[model samples]
Target: MNNSNTAFELTIVVPVFNEEDNLERVKQEFDSYLSKSPYRSKVLFVNDGSSDNSQMFIESICKSSNKYSYLQLSNNMGLSAALKAGIDYANTEFVGYIDSDLQTTPFDFDLLMEYRHDYALVTGVRQNRKDSFVKNMSSKIANGFRRYMTKDTAEDTGCPLKIMKTDYAKKIPFFTGMHRFIPALIMLQDGKIKQVPVQHFPRIAGEAKYHLFNRMIGPFKDCFAYRWMKKRYINYEIINQG
Candidate 1:
């Protein structure tokens, strides 16, 4: 049975895809963070149709504490859909995101929470990333191109560690490459975003799903799609409502 007594103020969505090797540590680290979090927080693991034992691990974790819950997709819909599912299902004032690979620590959420009130989205910029040369180079090229095209001014939109008001997150329009345009989409809603430096570590388990094509070439093409959409996006304000 779930701990019905726990009060949840924030939902940290962890999207998992064949990450059975790291779920044990994920449970430990997240549990530690929840124990001392300033806000009453819960972890929601979205299993993106993993063929491994990830689903079993997630189920076990959720059963261990009411602080944890999960959503299992029918098939692998990629990160964008998995994240959108989690965001839509989240019933908290704020929603948080972190990768399951353990490169980014759940503890950095405290750093983001520091500015959560002032900014619509608070994202972490990994300092001294522990990725390979090709991965780093591709990310730089992709991020630079995205900035030039979208003009979102986000230092590291690719950084997986982030927190945003659940309302703004839910308002974001969804698409195939939607994950790459989160900060830009938030900006479309006239939302404020703050990026802060955070620790980055080398991945100890599970293989990275991205490659040169998806990381660099794919985002390069998505920039044009984003530009096209940006011109057509609509927003409004109601000063007088009875």
Candidate 2:
């Protein structure tokens, strides 16, 4: 890790799994963001035990850029685990998440940062999504169900382009589908969230990790899990500590 990179205020964690084809584009997009971002920023590529050449590409990217680094998971623990690992690893004041696929632009992070001061979480809502009809409808159903269950009011929880304060992010409990409930989790901590419209593009390479079953049934199950956690969640404030 570059010592100077530690001075950054924001760390963007890009979780990767079998996204070897997308690494280069990811690097370029983030590198461009770092050059133009209002806040001092760096990118942390989390390798979620990708069985492809993703690690090789990640290592190469990290080696070539001081603004880039990575964490390698032992195996494919799924998106929630990978996101949690990245959040745990982040030491900056704020952390952001973006998918390895170039569907969302890293540049949109700047828009999220604009509301960073007022909201504990700032996430993107993709405008004019370029996915297939099945993908779009499934996502809409999933989002609607999640909103009804968690009452997070997040239109696009699965947008994948989000920024949140590191402290708030660290407070979230790790679970298989925690990634889908980030805004709700922040709300659990009595934190505020803001959503901004962001540009979305079609995937240029690599296969999507999710399917109809996982997108619909998986989130349906996780919604109940979230409700259970919400009921049992505990929050308190300490006036003083010795």
Candidate 3:
């Protein structure tokens, strides 16, 4: 219920887990990016109940910078919950998202924001994914199946960069793997979503957080959910004046 007033022009949500090593680098990257971005943007860090020193690092970053801010859940929530929480609390016209592992460059947001006006959501597709063969192949298989089921056809829904209208992003239902269905969900609501190619880098410090189960099995089940919702999803418009 907080942030009821519209103030920030953009809120960039950074979802973090046990990424203590990458935390400071993430803040500096965003701070440097905000210096040049046309629209003033504030960074929101969501700590997903990390048992590490992630919360302390987030607080230090917030205290050092006025544009930086953060929130920590009582316990670890999944990525979907963390993202939805940020969107719910965001009081900006545009809410952007990126991961804390530093896989994607924060400054690449300029590419997405350029088309922000015409799109309800702007997402990134990694043309040259900087992942291992196993990671890359598994993602491809998952993406293909997801497209067949949900028919969203987003080349890289797994890419960790996006900018969306706060209102539309807030309306998306919070399923466990709903993060993968953002473009599809926006399409279902008759909203426009643009996908742009962005830079991808290898993880520098922390270990790969995703395992085979979460990447392959988790998304498989959620795809079925997306299809089910797609069939029964509600959409209506008022026709005429009284």
* TM-scores for every predicted model: 0.96, 0.97, 0.94
TM-score between candidate 1 and the true structure: 0.96
Flag the better candidate by TM-score, 2 or 3. 2
Model 3: residues with Cα > 4 Å off, grouped in runs: 1-7, 237-242
> What tens digits encode model 2's per-residue C-alpha lDDT throughout 29-88?
877778887788888888999999999999999998788899999999999999998898
Give a tens-digit lDDT track for model 1, residues 1-242.
23242377788999999999999999999989888878788888999999999999999998888889999999999999999999988888889999999899999999998998899999999999999999999999999999999999998999999999998999898887889989999999999999999999999988999988889878988898899998999877679978
Ranking by TM-score: 2, 1, 3
Q: Which pairs, if any, clash in model 1? A: none
* lDDT computed for candidate 2: 0.91
RMSD of 1: 1.8
lDDT of 1: 0.91
Clashing pairs in 2: none
Q: Please list the C-alpha lDDT of all candidates, in the order they appear.
A: 0.91, 0.91, 0.87
lDDT of 3: 0.87
For candidate 1, give the lDDT of residue 216.
Answer: 80
Off by over 4 Å in 2: 2-6
lDDT of 2 at 93: 88
